[model samples]
Target: MRRIGLCISLLVTVFVMSACESEDEAQTFADRDQETVKHTTVKPMSNKNKQDFQTLPNDMQLAIVFSSMIRVSEAFDYGIGNPEYFVRSSMTEGEADIAKENLESIQFENKQLKKQNNEAVALLQKTHNQEMSHNEMQQLKENRTAFFEVTESMIKLISQVTPKNAKKTRQQLDQLKKQYTQYSAESVKIMNSIVKKQGADKASFERHLETMLQKQPGQPMLSELY
Candidate 1:
């Protein structure tokens, strides 16, 4: 009977040890998982104060504006092409309804911008070793104007319809709007002079601009929000 009691005690002791081990293992795994999550989590984009584009060099300012225009144009194309998808993914029904109300107008704006983008691309491609004609330069000015005007209109409409709960999106839109204001005014005067050169000056500028365009990287600042 003493041997039997000893055996039972041993078994009880082993059982308690096993339970304790299992709990310790579970806790170790839980801690590791918490550490992994802490390391892997993605933080939200911060709104850092950026230097005004107007303060940048003329070439740099134009590069940014041109790159932003291209990125935003691509975004507009995606939204226009997949209206249902965009609405479903990014907006509530109420917001979708508001977007739909001005759908035609926005579509028209997109169409105009696309036309100008095509023109600019073609002009740049053929002007590799030559100067742009006065007419071509004029067209570029018009295209730049259209880009800012259309983008402003689009931003305002999106801002108006964006849900208040979309804090990140609203912040992004505001930042973009602020950028638009910076690049659209005095920067225009600089861009005009840059594009309005003649003879050798025009050719050099065109080649430089074309090379920049050809190697232009994607602008996530404008693309992510759209």
Candidate 2:
């Protein structure tokens, strides 16, 4: 009887130790799993959608091209002659080269028209007259008209480009379009104010333009410019 009792005590001690070791292992595994959950839960930043000029979505691509042309016109109107600003700010190096190549491919007639517009702006600046010559004024009107037309095109493009699976993209595009339209109207107000003051100083005008551009639909993409 004494021998049996001793054997029973030994067995109970071994069983208790084994049970404790199993509990410890399970707790360690739970802790490791909690760490893994924390690591996997962290989110990454969204990627930028690089514009491919060649393979542009038909409706969307034309909108971008026209928008770029309008920007070039605006730059000319405002005495911002450097294409580098548009090239560097609007696109990556690859896109810039693509755009430059495309622009170069235009026929002589279209190139002449672009040059004529530039000359018209220069003539107006030299004369310092709001009342420009017939040809110069006509070019100015064309530039402004193109800018407005492209703005409409861009709104349409945004509508088409919003992904079917992405409610957020649709919502974002809608809000962007509304803000851009409002700011487009306000740009005229600011331009008028500048004209009233006979055009603000370069620094002042730039600041105003920056503020205005910031309000536009696609300006967030310009963050990559910096």
Candidate 3:
């Protein structure tokens, strides 16, 4: 009976030891899984946070250029008045070059469009020697209106592309908004003068505006106003 009792006690000890080993193994696995989950979980960075130039699209590159221009222009408009304010945001020398190129392109395109518009107006005046029909006159008025509308939009867009300080950006934007309002009034006066002198109808004006819009490169995806 003593031997049997000793055997039974030994059996019980073995079972308890096995159970403890199994529990320890399960706890170790659980801990490892938790660590793996922690390591795998990560936050995705936003496009705005990315600093690399190569990652940006062509339109975005152009926008950066325009943004710099806007900032510089705004600085001058707001009494900050430094050209460096525009180019300072560029990440690299190459980016600065690109920005400069974009500005040049925009200026060039504006000049070309203005020249074309003047020529079109002149041609219209030459063609309409006699009194035109009321319908023809109305058409001319509509075209002139559309052209001015597009011009104002372009100015506003250009102004919006300018970058500003975080503290003053909002104020700068407000200034741009006001400037656009004034710009529109001035544009209307100019358009009326062109129409009155040239007798060019609205259809010709719209076609010219459309051509200008088509010539302009595609805007950036990130642009706030295009």
lDDT of 3 at 121: 37
**Highest lDDT against the true fold, candidate:** 1
In candidate 1, what residue range of length 10 has the lowest lDDT sum? 1-10
TM-score of 1: 0.30
Comparing 2 and 3 on TM-score, the stronger one: 3
Cα lDDT of all candidates, in order?
0.37, 0.30, 0.31
Candidate 1 lDDT (Cα, 0 to 1): 0.37
User: Of the pair 2 and 3, which is ahead by lDDT?
Assistant: 3
RMSD each, Å: 25.6, 31.6, 31.4
Candidate 1 Cα errors over 4 Å, as ranges: 1-96, 108-112, 124-167, 199-226
lDDT (Cα, tens digit) per residue for candidate 3, span 1-226: 0000011122122222322222222111111111121111112235665455434433333223222222222212211111112334323445444333433333334443444334333333333321433444345445544544544443333333433432243344345444433432333333333333444343444343333223322222122211
lDDT string, candidate 1, 39-140, tens digits: 211121234644543344334433433443443333343332222222333567576665554344435455545554454444332332225444545555
Candidate 2: clashing pairs of residues:
none
**Backbone clash count for every predicted candidate, in the order shown:** 0, 0, 8
